[model samples]
Every structure is written in structure tokens, then in C-alpha cells.
Target chain A: MSQDHSLNLKNSHEDPAKATMEGKNKFLGLWFFLGGETVLFASFFATYLSLRESTAGGPTSQELFGLELVFIMTVLLLTSSLTSVYAIYHMKNNNFKKMQLWFGITALLGIAFLACEIYEFAHYIIEYEFTFRSSAFGSAFYTLVGFHGGHVVFGLSWLISLMVRNAKRGLSLYNAPKYNTFAIYWHFIDVVWVFIFTVVYLMGMVS
Target chain B: MTDNTNINKINSYENTRRKEEMKHQVITFVLMIAFTLIAFLVVAAELSRTFVIPFILLLAVVQVGFQFYYFMHMKDKGHEIISSLIFGGIWIAAVTVLTFTTIIWW
Candidate 1:
């Protein structure tokens, strides 16, 4: 343990003044955090996949998922991911104004995506009478996709806060790391959506 | 101190470079959206069940890869170690899901 600490300290010498060791620690810590989040979503995915075939006299993926709407939602979220990339690019360049602009756009896209998702769920519940209580499959499907939607909500809030808090101050070394970390989180969410699209939507529809 | 001044200079240089890179990032972003929309259309159209699902999934995976490597800059800085950790965790989770599915279903 002591040797590891010493090694870390030695390496810290290279970028010592740039980001404090605390910053590195935060980065490392966030990675671990994301690991936990992976497990959480994995469990949800597993449950959804396992219960996927259990239509239970209710709507299955094929019956429920309209490719058109799902496709639109995917486009909205994907565009949001791109906007976030722009935000982070500005962040790296220390272009605070541009970063804020891009971040704001990203947040708006996220909001649009979330609104679509909510409407989709409402359509599911109202039209099909398929809901969390309808069947085990319904429960699993809603829980998995709804959990992701929840994350999008949280991410939008986080983006908004970062944008508002740092708007006037501009990007400092301190705030730069904050935006950097936020970008990491946002991209991770996008990654999970990719898997959800594949396993939950595509596979569910087919199998 | 000279060190502080030098650090400031380096930061300013990085700032300028990042600004220049923003355009490229936006371009990449646009491409990603296009790819995603195309994949969605392919899936929705139900071009061919056997081929289409896998193909769209593959496209989605590629887009995710682009988001990770380019937008997140996972290729730069200390990202290797963190990314590996993430991948490792994913592998384990995947295996666990496979095992559970086999046990429960079979």
C-alpha cells in the first residue's frame, strides 16, 4: 500500500500543479462509481431479458414498440450526445462561452428526449393498458427503460447546474475538471443506451 | 515563479488548441447523429430480421465507440486505465447475466 502511494506521488510530479491530486482522485473515484452503475444496469437488463418472453396476456415488445417512435427517441438522444461532445470540446479549449452554448444545446436535446420518453410510456400505459402492474414483463421493461430515463433526467439537471454555476465565472482549472467529469458521465449514459437499444428493443422485438 | 508562469502559458496554449478542436468535435457529433438515424431507420423498416437487428446493433455499438473515444477523449490522458476498468466490469456483468439466464431458463 505504501509503495503504491509512493508510486502515485511520484507520478503526480509530472502534472502536479495542473490538477491537484484531489482532482485525479476524483476522476478515479468517478470511474469506480461508473462501475457500480454498470452493475446496476446490468441487473436491470438481465431482468428485462429474462422476463422478455413473458407476455402474460399483455403487450410484448413487438406489439408495444413502434419502431418509428423508438427511432425518433434514439435520434434525439444521439443528437444530444453529439451536442455534449461539442460542449466538452469547448471545455478543453477553455472556450467558456462556447462550452456554455453547446452545453445548453445538449441540455435542451436531453429535455426533448426525456419528453418523448415520457410520452412514449404514457402511450404504452393508456393505449395498451400495459403497465408495471400488468405483468412481470411489464414491470421489468418499465423498470429497465424507466431507470435509464431517470438517469437522463438527472444528467440534464447536472448539466443545467454546471452551466448556470459556471456561466459567469468562466472555465477555470477547477471548473474545467467539473465539466470534464460531467462529459464522462454523459457519455457513459449514452453507452448504456446503446446496449438498451440492442438488447431491450431489438432483441426483444425479434425474440 | 517561473514555473507558475510556464504553467499558465501551457494552459493558454491548450485553450487555443481545444477551441480549434471544437469544430472537429462538432463535425464528429453530426456524423454520429446521422449514423444513429440511419440505423434507426434500418431497424424500423425491418429490412431483414436476421440481418437488420444485428446490423443496427452493430451500428449503435460503433456510434457508442465513437462517443467514447472521441467525445469523451478516452484515448487521451489517463483514460486507458479507467476505460479498462469499465470494460472489465462490463465483462463480468455480462457473464453473470448469461449464467443467470441459462440457469433460470434452462
Candidate 2:
């Protein structure tokens, strides 16, 4: 066998995303970062739950949240998660084109989610006079969900930059782990949204 | 001739492994979608708030598991660090939620 074949043999035992030491380090570091993010979100959730009922004669969740809209947003974000999985799957298979295509779809879905969120906020502000300053409930609601929307914005920009910078280089030792870590981050966002959908939207609607 | 045969075997093995991985990803994706739909339906049906809240939260918990285990590849070998980090975070989050719900409110 040639030298290239020997190198391939070395990587055969590990995942493509972790074929190198650097990749392993990045993957591990990103997970730790997400762990910190979990506590941050937990603090927000606790505050929101404590303040959720303190509308002070202002509009409450039952009066503000529309199940249909929130449901659509949930579906969009969940589908984006699936698309990102597909992207990483393609990355594993060494198909850069397919990976890019799937990531593009994921970003598009994220954009749609953001648009729906903005519209939902605008509708609340205009129809129900539910600004962030309206009441304690308003303040908590905006902080919790607004923080999530900000994450989506940051993730979308990150994905776009990664795709553009790597558009021509294709997947390699340097970029495979980057894509892999991004996929993990994207999944973490989806996981957080799952809780938001259940705790904030579904629970709020029923309560 | 023996070297060629050995190369072929390695290639086939890699292909088989990839197929297995793809199957797992697809299954996880389908299950996550199903969980989302059930959560929506539970809320839309206007069931008892008590029942719906816990039920939807359980479904969400399952979906999160699928995301972390399958999509994030934490179920694979060599992910112990990630698992520890995530579970530790969960422990802290649970404590925070409990403290708020019990102590602050009560």
C-alpha cells in the first residue's frame, strides 16, 4: 500500500469528524460550552415561570400565545434539526455537495422560524398591547423567548459563514470537525426549543 | 492478489458500518417528528391542563434524548466527556427549576 493508504488506515478506526486530535478537542469543547448554555437557559426558564402569572391586569399567556403559530414554529425548528442531521450524515460520507445542500435547507428553515417569531411578537404588540414594558409577565415572556430567537439569529449567521468559507475547499481535517461541531450546536438549539415548545407554549395554552 | 482481497474486505466493512449509522439517524429523525406532532395534538385537543403539561414535557424529554444520543453521536464510543458535561448540566438545571418552583413560590 502507498502512504495515502496508510493514512486512511489510521483514520479507519475513528469517526471522520474525530479523525484527528484537533477534531476531538473541538467536539469536546463545544459540548462543554453547550452545557454552560443549558444552565443559562434554566435560569431564564425559572424566572419566566415565576413571573408568568404576574400580568398585573395585563394580557397573559392564555390571551397572548396562539397555539397554531407556536405549533408552526415548533415544526419548523424540529424539521431544521432533521435537516442538519442529514448534513452531518453527508459529511460523514464525504459528500460535500450533499452536506452543503442539507445545511442550506436547515438555514432556510431557521429563517422561516425567525420570521414567524418576529410576526408573533409584532402581532402581540399591536393587537394586545403586549410590549415588554406592559407588565412583569410581559417582561418575563419577552426575555425567555427573545433570548431563544437571538440564538437562532446567531446560529444562522454562523452556518452561513461556515458554508461560504468552505464552499470551495470541501471537507477536510480542518473543516469536518467545524461542520460536526456546528451540527451539535444546531441540535442543542433544537433541544432547547423542544423544552420551550412544551413548557412555555403547550403548558401555557392549557393552563 | 491477497492484498487486493484484503482491501475489498475493508471497503465492504466500512460500507456496512455507514449503512447502520444512516439507519439509526433516520429512525431518530422520524421519532422526533412524531413526538412533535403528539405534543401539538395534546395541546390542540384541549385536554386537562394537568395531564397535558406533564405529558408534553415527557415527550419533549424523549425528543431531547434522541437529539443528544443519536444526532449528537453521544451514544457512540469516545463521547464520555460529552455525556458527563450534559448530565451535569441537567442536574444543575433541575436543581434550579426545583428551587424556583418550591422555595421562591412557596
Candidate 3:
């Protein structure tokens, strides 16, 4: 029933070192978040793999996939991941202008990637006649990849908000952690796309 | 009064140092992008799906490692316990998925 003095004491003595410690905690917490996201995608992937062959008279991965476009989209997302790194780099250096510039680039690349993905999905649905209801394989495939695309959309929004909010203020201990956390999330999204390219596209095409 | 002035000077110096370290974070970020793009190209080319799939995944895994250790500072001493717990959760999730799929299908 007694109030906790230790917690209050720590808060009262908050120094730069303490701020750094808090940043580390935020980073670790985000990692745990990404871990859960990994499992979420894993389940979708397993389901997709299981149903990959059940084309149900629909076009198969080999029949539908064109490597050239997927390749370009992949490049865009990957580059965005890199740009976000640059943003974070500027963040650490206390260079707010440079951080905003790089984050802007990252967000632009993410949008481009999303556009390509949407186009690709539309092509599949309209041209290839690959609807989610086409088969179990179709359902799982769209669910998994679509979920990732959704994450990209969400990330784009987050990046935009961060950029707009911090456009004038510049980097602070407060915003630096936000930028850092966003980078982690962006990288995690990129990582998931990697698995998707492998398990969903590559494996589907080959086997 | 002298001690207080010294403390402020040291604090400013530390702030500058921290900024420099953050600048170095750019290198790791660029490397992550390069790895990601290459993996994308490899997978997209449809180059020996058998090898490329695992290779691309491996590249991705490496990128994740960079984000964790460098950007996320997983190597920081204070985060050891939390990191282990996170890895533990991933392990459990992996096992559960594998078990369910294998048991039900096979």
C-alpha cells in the first residue's frame, strides 16, 4: 500500500544518461514488438506454403509472376530502408535538417514501393484473374503479402507524421527516440518482405 | 562553483560525442539498404530458386541483425535480459507454427 519512492527518485534525478537509458528501453521494447510481428507473418507464411499447390484451377506462381517488376519493387523498399538509416544517423548527430531530408526520401521510396505493389496486385486480380476467392492458395497468398503491403502503408503514414511534426523543431532527445523507433519498424518491415520474397514468391515459382 | 562549471563543460563535450556516434549510424543504414536491394534482385531474377530463397532469407536475417545490434542497440549491456526474452518468444512462435503445420499435414 506504500507509495514507491525508488521509482520517483529515479525520475527526479533524470539526467542525460538516464535519458539514454530510457531510449535503450524503448529500443528493446520495439524489438519485442517486431518479434510478435514475425510470428504473425510466420503463420501466414506457413499457411501460404501449405496451400501453394492448391491452385484450384487458378494461375500458379510461375504462370503469374514476372520477376522484373517484383525485382524493382524490392529495390525500392530496400533503398527506403537504407534512407531511414541515414535519417537515424542524422538523428544521432543532432542534425535535424539532414534527418528530415533523409526521412522524406525514405517515405517517398516507401510510397513508390506501395504503388508498385498495388499495381502488381491489381494486375494479378484483373489480368491474371487471381482473386482471393479463386482458391485457398489465393487467399493465403494475398493475406500474407497484403498484410505486408498494409504495413508499408502504415509506415509511410508514420514517416510523414514524424517529418511534418518535427519539420521546424529539429531533433531533440524526444524526437530522436521517435525517429530511432521508426527506423526499427521500417527495417522490420523490410525484413518481412525478404521472407515473403523467398517463401512466397521464390518457392512458389520454383516448386 | 568551479566544480559546477566543470560539470557543465563535460556535459557539453559528451553531447557532442554522442552526436558524432549517431552520424556513424548512417554507415550501417546504407549497408542495410545495399543488402536488401541485392537480395531483392537475386530473388526477382528467378535465379536458382532453391539456393536464392535461402540466400535472400539469410541476407534479410543479417539486415535484421544489424537493425537489432546497431540501430536498436541490442548489444547494450542493459538490454540483455529483454533481448533474451524477445528471442525466447520468437523461438516459441517458430516452434508452435512448425509443430501445428507438420503434425496436421503429415
Reference-based TM-score, model 3: 0.79
Error of 2 at A203 (Å): 0.5
Off by over 4 Å in 3: A1-29, B1-56
lDDT (Cα, 0-100) at A202 in candidate 2: 80
Evaluate model 3: give its lDDT: 0.74
C-alpha lDDT score of every prediction, in listed order:
0.76, 0.86, 0.74
Candidate 2 lDDT by residue in tens digits, A1-207: 244643343335346778778888998899899999999999889888888888999998888888888878988998898899888877776788999999999999999999999999999999999999999889988998999999999999999999999999987767888888899998899889989888888888886
TM-score of each: 0.84, 0.93, 0.79
State the lDDT of candidate 1 residue by residue for A97-197, as single tens digits: 88899889888888888988999999999999999999989999999999999999999899899888877886665566677677778888888887887
**What is the TM-score (0 to 1) of candidate 2?**
0.93
Query: Number of the top candidate by DockQ?
Result: 2
Docking class of 3: acceptable
C-alpha lDDT of residue A107 in model 2: 99
> Which candidate order results from sorting by TM-score in descending order?
2, 1, 3
Best by TM-score: 2
Separate DockQ for every predicted complex? 0.44, 0.70, 0.38
Q: Candidate 3, after superposition: displacement of residue B9 in Å? A: 8.3
User: Candidate 2 chain B: worst 10 consecutive residues by lDDT?
Assistant: B3-12
